[model samples]
Target: MNIKIPLPASGGLLLSYKCTAACRHCMYACSAKWKADWISEEDLVNILSQLAGKILPSPYGPDNIGLSHGLHFTGGEPFLNFELLCNALEIASGFDIPSVFVETNCFWCTNDETTREKLLTLRGKGLKGIMISVNPFYLEYVPFERTERAVRIGTELFGYNAIVYQVEYYRRFKALGIQDKVSFDKYLQLENRTDFARNTEFFIMGRAPYRLTEELADLYPRYPAGSLVHMPCSPPFLRDWHNHFDNYGNFIPGFCGGITLGDCRELNDLLKNGIDLEEYPVLAYLIQDDMLGLLQFTVDRGYMVNGDGYYSKCHLCVDLRKHLNAVDGFKELKPDGFYSNLA
Candidate 1:
């Protein structure tokens, strides 16, 4: 099947990679120990401005027009720098983005009075939605009541639809009794639960490969070599309508994590004139969805496996990218954390 690249309709700004609590499942391997600066107001303004330009105006009436463009702010903990997070929301609002959301671990919520005050302030600043991260990994450091409190506050301020509870994949698998025999199709079947919780899959990148893989080995059902290639990319890259911008205003394509596609400044140009994925050799191989082919390609490029078999296709893909990232041109494709022992 030919890979289809879709136009972006929504974007996520990774406010910063610094977090108050370090979750083992974090794809970015963020923690208090990680040294990264918060995104500047100027950078946020530039990114939102460029994003606003690419958003095609809706032909429908005013009520339906703003829905064409959406924006969300996330991070190791967006609340770590509350001011910056608020500033980002303000900017997105200024651009008339239909939806402005924020994802947080809710570690900052101390009490009902405090949480209500903070969330109400954010709501007044144009925050439209709130996604509270809740799972076993987060529960380790964050109290359940904190998440509950944040949820309550969010519902009161943004209404029920605006409040979302994001549960990690492993937790969902365990909840649905599919952990022992994993299947994506099975996952899809149970995705329609009426509960506020939304099942989110773990990307076998960052700390997950090292920190959580072995412990959950029995939960991961492996695919035969090259079979994953034919398996459709989740969110189907064609419908990957979202783009992620990091602290430096670098655009990370939704289909290609860690890899920086271009700067946010070039977003409008790239969107107007779509990119040729094949131009980036690794990305080209990636979109083909052939894990065995990708492995062979890596081997041909002087990579040797460490005798450790991967838990899944993503496991193998991440390992391969770690080696490819060392090559001069591909170095910036993925972040350095993917190649390090952040755990």
Candidate 2:
């Protein structure tokens, strides 16, 4: 069946791929290794214009009340480009788009007053909320204090609008007396368990599959490419609830990172006419026959599968996409840096 993802009801824009931290679980593989490539004002406006009224009611609001707008500003970290982020919030406001928020790792939350000032500035620019990331991965780079301060002030300012991505991790870190950053190894040591990912919403894709094979081994065992299950990724690909448009103008369907459905620059036409599988050969194969289709396609292009096997079908898909991105130059495998930065 041809794949045509429904218009997104909830999503964010990745302002850039450059992040302060190179987290092991980063699905986008965002890190300092990336160049300083923030999204242009033109592209941002174009994307927001197309998405302004297409969104459905937001699930985050009460009875789908006043906060139904589902647009958000994100990036390797939206705070990295404070001016651009402010502009983004203002632009969304001009479009009468409410409930707009920003996602961050809180690397910029150096002091309480400073953080409060920035939050207030954004809020004044029509910002609705904020989501501060709190996980073992983020703990590896950002101090626990920064995240703590951001959440505290955000809650004070936005009330229930302040969100902690997995409040469980926030509570866990506090209970363990983690005031500063902890190394990944030490985090595991303190937790007294290796299967921490099992407790969180971990996806075995992108940098996770490459960096966390050992940590996630017991929970998701590896299987040979030939022996692994072959099912279409449509379930995740077709997910219309949340999708993202990247600074590179790639329409990232759901969380299938590095896979672009079509260019967001041409979003209006794509949405109106629907997508043609032939235009996205890699997406076509994944939608039609899953990794096996990509596996066969890559093999024909002189690629060899690792004898050691893979953690999951998504893992296999990433590896195959990496190979294709390097050799075949599939337009759908966008932001060539996404694959290169994995190493």
Candidate 3:
């Protein structure tokens, strides 16, 4: 189970503290509804000021990409702050050292030519390209045309540039539109490479924090709370985060930080006024230490826990509400097979 991979050499940069669309399944439902515990643009500037001796700003004068240790711009929707995103990229470009990646929904990639042009341009200017995140749920709001356009822009326009494009399919419900899922699958299939197994992920968490309706808790028809599930989070900050809870209180790692499950003994001081109750609305966070993990998980590490087996890993503090609505078995919509080494 110890799938040791390379240490993350990059940082998940919070570009803009906002998103445009409010997808139902968004783990935190990350919209204008919340703000992350990030150093501000000014804070970044100050950090840069102190680290000037170690790094440089973008290759483009006053350009955003130049300055950084390596960085990835993810958020409510990093593209929302396209200008700030560009500025950050300029800063990275200045340093000319980091390989930056953007985790985007790809919705905007198709609508605006300016955004498209900027992404394409970044390919040459040290931009690592996009992580075109797609899934069956995405089809609800993300039109087929847009997802297709995103692929074209990321692969074709960027000239088959470096990109991640993680996709996940759900097969739990037979009610979801078949055609929409099919179209989405085909789109991701084309984007996947031979080495990579799947272009998607089923790692639960996002907006709609665990939706445990009476119907869903019936995984075995009679039993409730079902079985536990867990995934190991590979963020360098995991132990650091776990320690936060053990010594202080029931909590989450800063990397996957969301809601704290118990008393806010020490974390309150680190956060704004109080714990980030706004983003993580799960009651699981308030659970006792021993049972805190009943509803938690981290990504990058593996194991598929389900109704038959017990849950694993710490997921309570994070938002898993959306995934709680149903588990995916993904079959009829199989357009492509993601090449996972294990799979």
Best by TM-score: 2
Candidate 3 similarity to native, TM-score: 0.51
lDDT tens digits by residue: candidate 1, 1-343: 2333455676678888788877766766677775667888888888888777444433432122222236678877899888887788788778876667777888888799988888888888877667777655675567666776777777777674344445354345346554222232333446552231334545765566667655456556555445554555565433445667788656776734566665666666765565466666666666555556777878888988655466556556666777777654573365565355345
Which ranges in model 2 have alpha carbons more than 4 Å from their true place? 1-3, 60-69, 215-220, 232-235
RMSD of 2: 2.4
Ten residues in sequence with the least summed lDDT for candidate 1: 60-69
Q: Any runs in candidate 3 off by more than 4 Å, and if so which?
A: 1-8, 35-39, 47-70, 111-115, 121-125, 159-164, 167-200, 206-255, 259-315, 318-343
Candidate 1, clashing residue pairs? Answer: 229-289, 259-333
TM-score of 1: 0.78
Ranking by lDDT: 2, 1, 3
Candidates in order, TM-scores: namely: 0.78, 0.93, 0.51
Q: lDDT tens string, model 3, 1-343?
A: 1111112233344443355545544543355544433335654453333223322223432223311224456665776666666666666656553445566766665565855777766665556656666554455445655665666666665443334344333221122333433433343344332312243343333332233212133331221123332223443322221121211122333334333333323223333243343333333232222222434332212323344332223233232322332243222111111001001
Error of 2 at 179 (Å): 1.8
For residues 1-343, could you state the per-residue lDDT of candidate 2 as single tens digits?
4556687777878999999999888888899989989999998888888887876545655212122247778779889999999998888777766468888999999999999999999989988788888899989999999999999999899888888887889888988999899988789888857557646777778888888766656666788998764655645676666688999999997777888888887888877777688777888876665667778989888789889888877888889999989888898898898998875
Name the candidate that leads on lDDT. 2
